[model samples]
Target chain A: MPNIKELEDLTTQVRRDILRMVHKVNSGHPGGSLGCAEFFVSLYQEIMDRNEGFDMDGKGEDLFFLSNGHISPVYYSVLARSGYFSVDELNTFRLIDSRLQGHPTTHEGLPGIRIASGSLGQGMSVAIGAAQAKKLNNDDHLVYSLHGDGELQEGQNWEAIMYASAKKVDNLISAIDLNGQQIDGSTDDVLPMGSIKGKFEAFGWTVIDIEEGNNIEAVLKGMAEAKSLTGKGKPVCVLLHTIMGNGVDFMMHTHAWHGKAPNDEQLEIGLNQNAETLGDY
Target chain B: MKTYTYKEKKDTRSGFGAGLAELGRTNPNVVALCADLIGSLKMNQFIDENPERFFQIGIAEANMMGIAAGLTIGGKIPFTGTFANFSTGRVYDQIRQSIAYSGKNVKICASHAGLTLGEDGATHQILEDIGLMKMLPGMVVINPCDYNQTKAATIAIAEHDGPVYLRFGRPSVPIFTPADQKFEIGKAIQLTEGTDVTIVATGHLVWEALEASKALHEAGISAEVINIHTIKPLDDKAILDSVAKTGCIVTAEEHNHLGGLGESVARVLAQHRPTPQEFVATNDTFGESGTPAQLMDKYGLNSAAIEKAVKKVLKRK
Candidate 1:
């Protein structure tokens, strides 16, 4: 396994990929992508028990689904960096006919994506189903999924939440990026969901909170604990308290960059802040 | 005229249940999911036979669709059962993104389709399901005629590779088709031959079209009858060939005239043959509380309606 320094370097590199990809397209989302760099790096490079190659039916291997798929920039970077595809393919992000769509999808046969999810709140149900499939196949493997905290307002997530515990689906771990920011404004100002932790607990889930979601070590540890909590008669949820845009100083602490791409000057500043640890695509 | 008969009658939902039960014993990869309508969809037989393969996803149709799509990730063929309204309209976005767009192999078996759902009113009866499903790029829209055909179509779709929407009704229709007929997707069944006017019908209307043919024969009009089981990937050749012989056509279905099988046949004819066609379907309106037979007659979805349409089209020809 990679040490703390190597993992942090990978996260920084992934942040760079996220910024550069969005900058090139002038359309893709960058805020949520930057916020999820550390978690994606830690999960793919450290946490997940993945197989050597990719297949639609990921038998006998841990599966991951990206519920909040607007963060495709970070997902594509981490997938490419982890050898699912060439990192150079990140250059094709959001171009016509490219596998890397603005949102993640299996439509173009993108190697890592199992479902199309730009429409939020459907991922938890999908994760539960995959976990159930693992049980039916008698394959001792877990299924992991990622979602946005603001996305829980979609109503379908509650159905899945109420269901996962009722059915005792114990082989699934879902992480919500509690960035607290959405397109219009902060989640609090838009529509408060009272308490996410309380909500999951009330729904009978095993909830874990990562105080520093942007920190690679914290994300790794939180996810590890999440894995340990599986197979205990309830689904697992990790509330990751992350900044909307973590690496760049200007983009941080605001919802303006939720779907907007960085201009040339802003892109330069963002790139300079996160020095290229691994070479650029 | 070619005559048809049936010794017994059964609801098409029961056929779906019987087919699912048979699949449980044969196809180990086949799994079933229902959104709190086991009795309504007649899925108890399958659930009883393979309890492990059945997922009772209580009252949450959107989650059921998403779960069915996810179940396909591990190479499992998930057949989601629900009322037609909840199956298509309530979860269209879920089906479009997860199953149809992602190209997941899920069989969305919907029961109690069209006005024959009866007494539940417009809220439960979905007339726009075929149009909604066929609008998705890769979705296969199928509406079988009777119990035998519904069962065969259900089993046949398991061998198919992508998303499919199998539509059946709640009423007990006559079982005229053979017991061991080979079910073919996208292939239309030519029930009878004629030369004056062609009557093409689907779902509950196929049996009515055959009856219409008999009445038209008695009226000295040779009306050809065709059963269009699959609506999308429509059997254009069958419609075109029959229309080539017969000058005019009458399209019938248990759905609205706007986006039902009639509109599909009109598109094919407008492009290829430009034949004069009359639609025997409900106008853009909602159904009210009534018995199945009462609703059929009220909405003009019976054999008498088809006969009237055939006569009208014959006059135009």
Candidate 2:
């Protein structure tokens, strides 16, 4: 039910924002941000039934939490584009006195962020708690969260995962970014969690696998399917298979760009790849 | 000094349970989460009354802390129940990032704190929980004495709008405070007035402080007694005014000499009054297996210890 053309345009702008924001500071985790641009754009623009104005208590609306907070550039850009804050503030990403922290946090009173999450593996438990709250309120709304593939290594996620299914937290959707890369190396090199989909299935989540996570239509189709699977008896998990850096040529398929920013020449090349779709923030 | 008496004795954890049950009946927004040890936490009545509001997190303290933070997003005031050791040290990062730094209205109701949580020994008995909790900014740390006051503090924190670390213990100490007393955070209750050394105490030591005041009065010392329930956002006016009259202080608690209520009071006195003080607490050592009463006496956390501290600090005065 979305205009595919506009979603693509929004994704392009988000990619540009990710590059420019990180490039300005000569720092940030651009690999994950670029890879998650489409997911962020689709969630904010099409998927979530949200209010025009932001409230700390997101009561009556479908809530989305980015568990993999290093991808905050994409999250912030999409939030700005979707009218959470001024798009011009994207320039202050990771700067002093700015709400746009390198990782998403509510400590700065950022409107879109509900909790601080630079530290990995905490978002899942928080999301599950939100889902439980929705059930307590009889709100009939869904809670969605996105986590990095590498972040699954944290022991706390398993504790939360086991709890969600055991409690029948059926109104929640947790999507894992299956980019297979981390800061030090690929997930396999760091600490391999074999068969990520099978792992979630064993933990009792209804699994949805999207092979092309970077493609806007594929992600939309996958997410819609995920929303349909909710409210049954178990929490849902989406195995989003994506390249580390999808938009740019040099950064793709490598863990080297995990937390590094692009240089001036590399920035120009990245910008040339994604045209000015909705104008750079 | 004026004498006080209690008809019975009760654990502060039971007070928390009573307050939680009251909240369940009154405030529909209140929710309870426990990481195991529900019986130890004395949360059976609340869980039984409001099964939907109760969350059994099953030994995952970190996840419980995180979920408590998340529950605040949808306007549910979550109270996480666990032992003080696990509540403060084990899931510190989860609380730091999710609740404290984010400033969520989650009540971390920790039971079984300090040497009084005996039989389980040092692993379960956390002497430094007050210090660990009070160090976090925007975290309102409270260690109420007696069953009545803990219950009042529990009910009061639910009405407060920020993160609160509500600390209580397992042992059944004397319950002297009025059952219907209006509990105020950061406001010290003046138990007995005097002009000699100020005897400020918290947790299980408050009753000991009262007893010390009585003995000191009999010995003609005229000792002052104050109940410092809330450690952070401390009752500075009461402490400063009392110290202005008394000139020196003897701080006591069922905790360590470092980073506990004794140190918090010391910081305030050092900055303002510059009064000499003696601490009646565990001397930076771990507790061993013993009865609560035995441990209290061994670690200098009793009426006699408070009496000795009062006498020592009066010499400096």
- Give me the candidate number with maximum lDDT: 1
Native-to-model Cα distance after best TM-score fit, residue B243 in candidate 1, in Å: 0.2
Error of 2 at A192 (Å): 1.1
* CAPRI grade, predicted model 2: high
After the best TM-score superposition of candidate 1, give how far the Cα of residue A224 lies from its true spot, in angstroms: 0.9
Indicate the residue-level lDDT of B240 in model 2.
Answer: 93
Provide the overall lDDT of each model, using Cα atoms, as 2-decimal numbers.
0.93, 0.92
Give one digit per residue, the lDDT tens place, for model 2 in A1-281.
Answer: 68999999889988999999999999999999999888888888888889878998899999988888888888999999999899999989999999999888888888888988888999999999999999998889899999999999998999999999999999999989999999999999999889988888998989989899999999999999999999889999999999998899999999999999999999999999999988876
TM-score of each: 0.99, 0.99
lDDT of 1 by residue, A1-281 (tens): 55999999999999999999999989988999999999999999999999998988899899999999899999999999999999989999999989999999998888888999999888888888888898999988999999998999999999999999999999999999999999999999999989999999999999999999999888988999999999999999999999999999999999999999999999999999999999999
Q: Per-residue CA lDDT of candidate 2, range B1-317, in tens?
A: 57789999999999999999999999999999999899999999999999989999999999999899999999999999999999999988898889998899999999999988899899999988888899998999999999999999999999999999999999998999998899999999999999988888998899999998998898999888999999988998899999999899999888899999889888888898899999999999999999999999888899998999888888887
DockQ for model 2? Answer: 0.86
Q: Against the native chain B, what TM-score does each candidate's chain B reach?
A: 0.99, 0.99
Clashes of each: 0, 0
**Candidate 2 chain B — worst ten consecutive residues by lDDT sum?**
B308-317
- Which candidate gets the maximum DockQ versus the true structure? 2
